[model samples]
Target chain A: MSVDVHLAFPPLARIGDPLERVSTPALILDLDAFDANVGAMAAMAKKAGVALRPHAKAHKSSAISQRQLEAGAVGICCQKLTEVYPFVRAGIRNVHISNEFVGADKVAMAIELARHITLSICVDHVQQVRDIGAAADAAGVTIAVLPEVDIGQGRCGVASEEQLAALADAIAAHPGLRFGGLQAYHGGIQHVAEWDQRRVAAARSADKAAAYVRFLEARGLPCPVVTGGGTGTVEFDAASGVFTELQPGSYIFLDGHYGSSEWLGGFRPRHGLFIASTVMSTAKPGMAVCDVGLKGVAVDSGLPRVHGAAAADLRYTAANDEHGILHLVDAQQPDRLGERLLLIPGHCDPTCNLHDQFVCVRDGVVEALWAIDARGLSQ
Target chain B: MSVDVHLAFPPLARIGDPLERVSTPALILDLDAFDANVGAMAAMAKKAGVALRPHAKAHKSSAISQRQLEAGAVGICCQKLTEVYPFVRAGIRNVHISNEFVGADKVAMAIELARHITLSICVDHVQQVRDIGAAADAAGVTIAVLPEVDIGQGRCGVASEEQLAALADAIAAHPGLRFGGLQAYHGGIQHVAEWDQRRVAAARSADKAAAYVRFLEARGLPCPVVTGGGTGTVEFDAASGVFTELQPGSYIFLDGHYGSSEWLGGFRPRHGLFIASTVMSTAKPGMAVCDVGLKGVAVDSGLPRVHGAAAADLRYTAANDEHGILHLVDAQQPDRLGERLLLIPGHCDPTCNLHDQFVCVRDGVVEALWAIDARGLSQ
Candidate 1:
């Protein structure tokens, strides 16, 4: 009884429609801005002699992932195992999961997916290696296993070289598992909001990860790759000269959280993603109610900003689950009912998760409608 | 390229499976607690002589809506037109939208939905009324139009009595529209925290809405049905003697926001809804990482709380888009990888929107599987 069977209508806009005519709560992607971001990030990785592997969790669209691959990405990064199937089935080759695979069920799925395409998963524990190796051997497929090392994020990854050495040995002992290098990502440093803070964090991360490369080499196991970086600090990670690969996700659809941060040091890509909403009510004097709110976008990073050159003083201050309160801060007149307004989401990752498809637009015409082919596939 | 074509897998559990075997990031609904909540709220409204209309936007599942209807709920309260189709198609006779309909697309959908069953929508302006009336006239169905008044929550709704009268007049003037009294919802008061603060806000709301009823009566437009109240202040609203019906959405699955609020006065229901996640990473000494994160649950209210008899001191503190950080505050040993954990989401409404289905469990076994059929139909 899923609404997908009946929700054939209520789409915000059709192809070849102008921005003002699109329906509210539609995920609109400006191709002009999106292409620039893709090119810039790809070029940055290439100039530093690093293989670019864009994270598909940011967009969740196979078409977007294909575009990134066409732009010289060595592979696509799946945040989890369930997310890998859609991209692989949609013809994306060489999928690398940037996160961990814990249980037997997930390990079995990874082995099954590896039989079709080149599959790689991150691991920081000996048990995970044993579980994945058992499944991969049973399926007769070699799954690349990257041992994660804690650089600075403190969220995940192995904290010490001893643990990394243990995980690598466990992988080497398994027949169907190949030893991939370190997955050292300092996710917290990606949003430091200051240039020096980010640079310092990246230097620390690079030094720690490079030390792991040396540690593994001293034990007769040379680390082949070091994969980690994001939109906020990809430049620093690339310039670190120790990393062999980069995984930057959000650069294709720069959002308010990243746009407002100045830590990237002059690499301000254009904001491409927007949630188009219509003003539903203007009865409360200076405040107007829009259709999209907490359900439409992610607010953990921050509130959505009003997207317009003329809407400088207009603000989206508060939100209920489905309604956003738009305040006419310095305006002389309130926005009329049914007026369409574009909103720049606070964070692109979860905001993209809320959508089923992306209305890809160039100028005022719809170029193509891309399905978020991996939406809701987070395992 | 839609994931729907490939996402036929990854559903957490089937019927009769124990909770321990369910997949990670699954929406788990405890039917026992859910049924108790439904009965409690229904009895509370029955004692106050108020008709109970549970909001479907909370769970977004037609199965739960059917249960509410079977339990003596006066139909269901939908927040938008796209939300109405599923309930009406599923044979729920009456559906009332708690928000306003401004555009032509929504008005047309409302009119179409009205042709099949009873459809009532809220309006604060004459334009909404006129548009609905014209469409209803074309479709040959009378749509019940409820005029919204600003009842402390300064978002949406008309502010003055004169505006309410004007909207009533507009509804009466059209052959396709009918006046259905007032929608006076004081939303801000629901999360006021303190009992006295919520009580004061409810009193103010009741007083203002009662004054409007008298004003409308003196002007020859007698108010009939008054609907507005939520999980936190439903009792206060019921005792006010001004409302004929109550609309509370989140009472069935009490969330972290409502559970922590003392405004409910010791009436803490068992948390019915949970995000069942897997402990993916335990590399750190005292911190555990789960697969559920910002995309898995809403954090506008607060972070999730660990659920289980043994997890008294385990707290879910920080979150990225796809990772929840579980801190072992009191326990010396960290949670092992691949262990299942239940997370009571901060806010139930937006958290329900994240997943496509619900795993209905009872007595440690899955009783049934329900689709979040109305998920993402927020347009």
Candidate 2:
């Protein structure tokens, strides 16, 4: 729905203003915390001798992607071909679709995108590779093809080493398609809850990646690169010799789900992302409602925690489409209507997709405004 | 995030095209079904002597709102003040915000909008009334204020008639505001599953609303209108004389959750809304993935059901951010990549909010494209 520019409330606050002045249900990015997380991630990847190919799907902001690239990220990983346009348009090169591209239309889209910048995509089935190769050939563009192996996330990707070899053969046969090693990652393993469980899961996933690499190399098709690791598994993945690159999207904007995991063992990253919400209605003494809900943030991971409200026990118990229900967890601290509260989203990815722009605040002052450039580009 | 006109992909199809030609992850509105649903709702409400104030929060499309108004329905209800702008901008005079408005900025915005359109809003606290009254006074506008009483949904509403009377008195104290009616809705009761349960819930909710009316009237504070009913409870609500107006937004779009309920036993509304997704990856015969997931459609209530694939047992098993996993339930029917499949969302309201535009189709051909004019205006 298009709105008149005058009526639309884009930036919640002006530059050099405090966070309290920002409007309700606005996405807030703590720049100081964000930069620190970025630096930490960059340093970890550099020491591990692995390129940090940050997933743009996390922030979906080209501004954040620019900063990541500036901080030694090899490239940005995109989930959809349409998502690549924003980051690549902002002058970032080496765009990789970590997910599979299906159908002729979407493959053609990927082929078209390859014309502008260096593009790579994952594939499990040979038919998908054939379609991609044909499109790339038609468009006179070369696309690096990564055959994704199922590293235990029972979703997409090939199950065996033989299937991986077959996909590699399919890619080599096509003139326009180049074989670009393995795309292996256990998506569900990132949020295993238990630290020990995550470590075991990450180690097992790396073992699978290593097995895929060894099998491909012995079969005379030397795997050029092995890319796969999320925020939770990146450190464990670094110890494994197979992976040359890591894809950690949520490291910059840590969420409640990640905060639960002991994956960030020693490095306690600050909460970089928050939903700035104002109490809209106080119907009773013990209850209050905020102007942020299922539409403003996400609830798939779980209900978000009230950020920085240490004095009060204010838990986000429930959410409707446009309202978040808050209960007085601690009767000592009372909530006043119109007072602002910061929320840590249950999941950072989908929450970012819900908003159009992100307010960058630093030292209690609105530093900048960043557009979530690839907000709904899930084509 | 705003994109260049050339790069935007909001509309998946043009006019005079087949359903199969429409883009994947596109919102589809079967016009024949939509018109039939609208006619059915209007006829039912007309016979019941209760006006149908269709909730705009469901469709969020001015086109659909216009069609509903033309079908003998009263003005629609919105969830937010900013959401009211697009509907009003399209020439809808009466805009009722079913949800509470908070903060000075939002109430001021509502007051400004009241200058052009007849505005009605709900309030659960005295502070909310004070805020609205102040803004309306400054703007020189009269706002119809409804005191919200919680019948069942423990979100944002007054607990008792005494509290509601206090709010009404506060509204009467302000010259800029007028006492509208009682905002009583047991939101979750509408989807109780069993026919008897919904009837009981609806009757109880209506009883509470009737009690509020009597209490207010006894105190010399008359309620002009009593409005609250969703798709599931409208029939029972019609039996109650208290509700002068019914707000059934999702009735036009039959979803999986509603379809499972026995409430609509007599009248099985046609499935109006659909997620027209193409089978992206048929990596294996048993498993196929579609290009629709959390970002494309919501998965809060449950995963969406596959439509028109009865011969094949295709269950939408799981979802990634941009993909839907489908498994062959019957194990007999084969799914091919690029084959189009229609999906009935679990919940219609949030699903409608995810998409920017709805593709209107009639007789297997594209008819018109309608913008979801109030989508993402949850400020």
Q: Say which candidate scores most in lDDT.
A: 1
Interface RMSD of each: 5.1, 5.4
Give the distance in Å from residue B50's predicted Cα in candidate 2 to where it truly belongs.
Answer: 1.9
Against the unseen true structure, what C-alpha lDDT does each candidate score?
A: 0.85, 0.83
Instruction: Report the C-alpha displacement of residue A200, candidate 2, in angstroms.
Output: 2.8
Question: Each candidate's DockQ score against the native complex?
Answer: 0.49, 0.44
TM-score of each: 0.96, 0.95
User: Mind giving the per-residue lDDT tens digits that candidate 1 earns over A345-365?
Assistant: 989999999888899889868
Per-residue lDDT for A140-188 in model 2, tens only?
A: 7888999998888777788876788789889988899999888998898
> Which parts of model 1 are misplaced by more than 4 Å?
A1-10, A263-268, B1-10, B263-268
Give the runs in model 2 whose Cα sits over 4 Å from its true position.
Answer: A1-11, A264-268, A330-335, B1-11, B264-267, B330-335
Residue A335 lDDT, candidate 2, scale 0-100? 56
Is model 2 an incorrect, acceptable, medium or high docking prediction?
acceptable
In model 2, what is the error at residue B292, expressed in angstroms?
Answer: 1.8
